[model samples]
Target: MQKLRHSSLAIAFSLLFSLAVQAAERPNIVVIMVDDLGFSDLGCFGGEINTPNIDSLASGGLRFTSFYNCARCCPTRAALLTGLYPHQVGLMRNGNSLTRNGVTIAEALGAAGYQTAMSGKWHLSRTQALPDHQKQLDWLNHQSQPDRTFSPVDSYPINRGFQRHFGPIWGVVNYFDPFSLVDGETPVDEVPDDFYMTDAITQKSVEYIREMSKSEAPFFLYVAHTAPHWPLHAKPEDIAKYKETYRDGWHKLRNDRYQRQVEMGLIDPNTYPKPELQGQGDDWGALDEATRKHMSQLMSVHAAMVDCVDQGVGQIIDTLKETGELENTLILVLADNGASPERYLQPGFDRPNETRAGKPIQYEGLFTPGSETTWGYIGSYWASAGNTPFRYWKAQSFEGGAHTPMIAHWPAGLKTKPGSTTDQPGHVIDVLPTFLELAAAEYPQTFKQNKITPVEGLSLAPILSGQQRAGHPALFFEHEGGKAMIADGWKLVQPKQNGQWELYHLAQDRTETNNLAATEPERLAQMKRQWQAWFNRVKP
Candidate 1:
């Protein structure tokens, strides 16, 4: 009996050792995505906002200058989650659902034994029907009532392979009192008075991380923050920090950010000349004093939202360190799309005209934004500055709308130099393949017996390891009828839906300032054919 006990103890010890080794081999992954942030919003990316936590990641890892998103919110998320274009996943437009034809990164990694969790906005599905009880709450508050039926169970994050999910099901929500708050499959009807969406999302993420650390298996956490998006909801203390920073106006702000980008080697000042400002010219002095003050306040609120997100990042980093998972963790930070240029408020069942605390919101006239009682947007003037030195804003096919800053930091994985930058052209579709490569996870040919589309992205592992590699032959993009194709530093973009194609040699004129279509007709035709082929393959 004594000999048998000794053998059993030895076997248990060996099993635990094997589990530890496996966990170390597959590093923990945390992908942090922020919404509606411009390319230059983070401090490390040449913006003035305080993003020290995110900046620290860039300082220790690599920053990609030519990374591209889908130029909108839901489409970008779909592409990033699946290793295919958004249209391939049936998300060609904002309200589309994820098709069964594609598998998500979580689904792939979870199948490989990685614990998966997501906290924050899950906008892949259409607006879900509200419960009868919640419908009564909406009616009692004099708010717009939603459809009676709920969203398909398969469309929720939990159904999409997230073992845990805590956030709103819809795309946009009031930061203070969000709609469709869900903890797993159940809806959270009441929230604490101090509950803020950004903070709550981070708190849930930290909790999930801490819990998962107890298990021997590795974990994947997606922290999607809906900060600084719209309605300009920010805490008073955060807003106070930037209330006076934009007093000099956007023209000066744009120039300052551009100069900083050059100084940091993030942009080539000579090759990429600043494009002409989109809306108003660089004449801050001409604006009336009242208009100037209002614009400044709006920007301050926007900056404040970004600041709060950074603070959450700091907390997450601290949690990792405390749990002894810091070194073996891979953290990626990026934005869904460029800065938004939307000027009007679109109130609907999703966007209620009331706060979570039962206060009516005013959408018109000159009222102080960033408060709970008001809804405000930064408009095109500041948006042009937000995407400094780039043309246009979100939803267009221009550089500003599609390009985003991407950061990757992993002490135990990446072999690249610290504080480095890569000019490799990458897209959101590449994210899943990159994560799969790191996790040693397989992208299945079929998931749950449904045939899956093959991944459309190339693994960026070579570039991350300090090796020279040829990237994708060409990247194609189309949204709301606007289309663009980039191949070998030559780009063909159409600003409007079904508009004439304009060509630009991105190597020389990345800003799309000088059109070269007429000069090179043959090259244009070839590229157009390539784009059409791609569109036919992926378009919904």
Candidate 2:
């Protein structure tokens, strides 16, 4: 009896040790994705924006210079959550639900004994915009539609494996009182007067993190911030910080950001000479005083929104530190798409006629921007500058539309030297696989009685380990007729649907200036075939 008791005690101790080691190996991954952010918007990415918290991630971790997104909001979100291309997951364009067939990172991780929570924009679900424009605006303004359901009940984040979710279901929202805000399945009917979407999203994320830390199981928290995406709304205090920053205008500002990129070794001038001011002849010197002042104010609002996101990042980091999960938690900060050129000149559907307090939301005549009663956008000229040294803006296949800044910080598992940078390309789809690998989770062939498409992303673990792992032989991209393929340092892009194709040796010219299609016909044709084949394969 005594011998048997000693044997049982030894086995129990060994089992507990194994479980503890497994838990330590699995990291708590927190993916923070911002909306319509430019490639060089963050200080770590060579912009003047005050993003010290995100910069700290770049400072203490690694930065990827060639990371890519789907070039739009909903598609990028779908790609990141599932390890599949946007099309494969039924989000080829906006206003679509993430297919049940696509397995989310949360679902995969949760099955592997991990806690899953999300806070912020859950634009994965289809937004039900009323056809009647006024009614839609009323719904968007939260004025008339008290019981409006933005999306299907089963499609919300909580229904898709996230135990806790707090965010808006629609893509565009009035930050002050978002149209489709919800707490899990229940609609958030009222918000405090001082409510700011960025701050609220961060608060809920902090709450989820603190609550989950009590449990032994690792957690996955996706902070999908809807900041810096337009209607150009921002708090006055935050806007004041950058009121005069863009007074120099987009031209000088673009040059300054590019020079900073060159200084930081993120860009090589000779190889990637700044593409000529993309919104050609955007000469700030020639603009009228009023126009110039308005432009600067618009950017200040955009910058202010980003600054608020950084503040949120600080809070998140503080929460992690407080829970003693800082070292073991893997934190990733990136954007959904490139800077938007969406100038809402005509306040149509989803644009409110009045604020929550009955003030008309102004977009014409005379009104200061970044306020609850004003509507504005950081137009293409500014966006061209926003996506500095790159061509085009959001919703295109050009580098500017798809390129994003990605920072990875994992003190316990990351082997890369601090403040180091990598030129290796990574796509949003890779995010799900990276998390799956880190959590020791498997991507299921069938999930919850639905058949899942095979994940189309390579794990970025090898890159984090400081190893030269194989990159995707051919990464494919397509959204609303725009398309691109980046393969082995070569990129082929088509800005317009059914437009002419342009090719470039990305290693030599990432700016897409010198079209090699005229010089390298055979290569261009082959790439066209490859992209077409991929498009066909992904077509649902």
Candidate 3:
């Protein structure tokens, strides 16, 4: 009897030890980036959009109230993925490529035995947008073919370190019929009838996760969704829900979002006043009924796009839970940039949807505002509110452009008490360093075949452990000459297209209403010169 009991005890002890060993293995990393999402889009971020999945993550993880990104899409992605400023990575704007100087986060993680994959928009490329040569190229490239296509290498994703790539390489595309998408090296021309771009990206990501689960190596999945960006398209069912909600113009919507933001504690009432709409047309109230309806419909579609993204987040979370990897996965979610205020010409980019070919289409603004056929955007009126009390919109060097919603979740590692928010001002560059430290991975001095620049961000691991570091001394910013410097909580910002220098204490006024440039001229001059010096060293 004693010998039998001893054998049973030995078996139980072995099983427990095996479980412990399995738990000691590294965790998978999933970085979900939403393109052109505003600061107030998510539920946790104080928007009216119902993003329960994302909100759940915030309720159970760390929410960074002052997270920053590069002022635009390609630049933000380049900086977030490469741990360098966008210009340093050669992605200063759209059509810029990832140069050999900086190593991507994928490359670094892959070196540490990570199965790297990326799905959805990959905008890092150096293709020149030449309207004059475009017609000639289309004719020359496809002489006899009805369907015209461009070369892949002009902006392929695989060349930039991701092992698996899917979705459009360009910035915008038809949601129904996407172009420049690939499954590995082969082109994917056909998509299912039930295909929504957001859903497709998520499905492909789920498939990648499943395939990588079989490998002993951990995985790094970059799921970049091109949702909620113009031309915004959403399912009919989803769009119907937000139909009458935005019937009121942007003025009312801005006020509503501001109230919600204050209620959520995302913004302090005493710190910043409600943002006033900028660039609104003088005849905004006098607009015709047709135009008013179209504008409201456009906003509805934008909201639905966000809803679809939230659904995608749900799918990813469910996948991890099903695979028993939820407990050990570190998930980071953020927007590529703040809400874009860019406006594109409507009436379709390609041949207009008309019966006659030689009718000489006049582009009478027939297409809906945010539809794929229109190519128009939700302008600064909506954009200002999209960013809540923040000033300006995308492309501005102010908080409105760079500040974004960032949430981090790690059941195994992040020990910050659940439902906690951090006021630490962090940037996209800090992500790479933080992940490297968490994964116990080292940045390669010479990645692949070329020497790489040292990472500029410090690891935010201390914050994850419910502690704060000394914090960043000076955070730099510049895009199209719009520049700013954040030292402690004071910010010095300049608007694009030759706007004057403005200064504010961010902690006291996050919206940047009080321009301290006149009051604190000496401080503004000092910071302006400092930013210029940093730009001299780092600018591309």
Candidate 4:
């Protein structure tokens, strides 16, 4: 009789143990970032391109209208991962290494018993080839053997915080023949004939999600894609879908996106009217048949790149749902930077290593890079419409460069208001704090024998809960003297070339078309002082 009583007690304890494990409340996180996507380039965000999977997230979650990036690729990634300003992380300029001081989101979450994996682009490096490095710059100029190669030290994704990472480590690489790619610590050299880089990354991400679902601990996945950024490569089939679509040129496309944006209810109809489109060198009616065809092809390639990213997003979301983890996983989707406005299609430009042994290698840009194939950038006129009603392009401190579409989706925890928009002031630096708050994790003061920089961001838990009002107060922005400052509802922006500061009440004019610099000199000066003080504390 005593034996039977002991057996009953053991059964009860085992059952309770199972229930406790299942009841754990910590949520998984997946932060997906795309490279160089335009603000109005997604269907959910007013772009005419069909991104149903992404649109689903917008329909089921909150879309942020006032989200901001660091205005460039490496800088934004550094800030997003470290929860500190990019300059503080040693990426004040391009090609700087991600220092060992701060704990990245992956490292922090990993310490808190989470599985961390990173895939796709990893551009944050502590060092790269400089002019003094073996005369590489001289070689490029003379087409001689380059003595120095572009190399990053101690800045690989896995080295920083991720347990597993796969993707290109450099800033940009050819989609078909990429450079400096790795899976974990090992370099990947071979790809199947049918291999599309975007599809491959998506597949790997899905597999990672599946494996993590079986683990007792939660997971944090950062999937960064090098799409729609450069070289404009895409599968032939995907390109075919958009071939004839953009033939009408950027003007029609911009209008179409604006109208679609209203239909999706992503933007307020009366909030801000569309800005005038700035015409470029070639008008739609002016270009010859062949030139027009080439333009259409280039635009098609760009669109396909985005479509691939959207498909990948859908795959991850579907995998999470299948494993019953979708409801609890916090998903944040954003772009790394603005659209490429460089004119890569200029005359007399050729790929560096294109011609060899009297054999012509077909290259395709308006001007080609290393080959005879002509390849060059599409100019600012098209890019203006790419960012859609926003001024300037990548590398600028203006909204066109800094502002991006941000979407958050969490079925179990985050507030779900389908088709709703939030104008809350949030920046890439705030992402780490938001995740930390959700996971109940603490930030460390130091890691790996290095003194860590304190995070300079506040948690957005209140904003997500819809309890807080107004964007972040005193938001500061700068990129080598192209500067802007926001305090209260007033914004002071300084254009390039030492242009006079312009003022605007952002709540009333988000497009920044009107310059109130002449009318509000006192307010502009006050805001300028505020920005200077903040920058002094953060800069050398």
Candidate 1: which pairs clash? none
lDDT accuracy of residue 222 in candidate 4 = 95
C-alpha lDDT values of all predictions = 0.85, 0.87, 0.76, 0.74
Tens digits of per-residue lDDT for model 3, 48-153: 8889999988988999988899888888888888889887888776666778788888888888788899999887765443254444323222222224333346
Q: For candidate 2, lDDT tens digit of each residue in 29-148?
A: 999999999888999988999999999989999999899999999999999999899898889989888998899998999999999999999888877667788877777666786455
Off by over 4 Å in 3: 1-23, 129-155, 346-366, 369-372
Indicate which candidate wins on lDDT.
2
Better of 2 and 3 by lDDT: 2
TM-score of 1: 0.92
TM-score pick, better of 1 and 4: 1
The C-alpha TM-scores of every prediction are 0.92, 0.94, 0.89, 0.87
State the weakest 10-residue window (summed lDDT) of model 3: 353-362
What is the C-alpha lDDT profile of model 1 across 140-207, one tens digit per residue?
33355444423566788999989999997777777877777788888777788888899999999999
Between prediction 3 and prediction 4, the one with superior lDDT is: 3
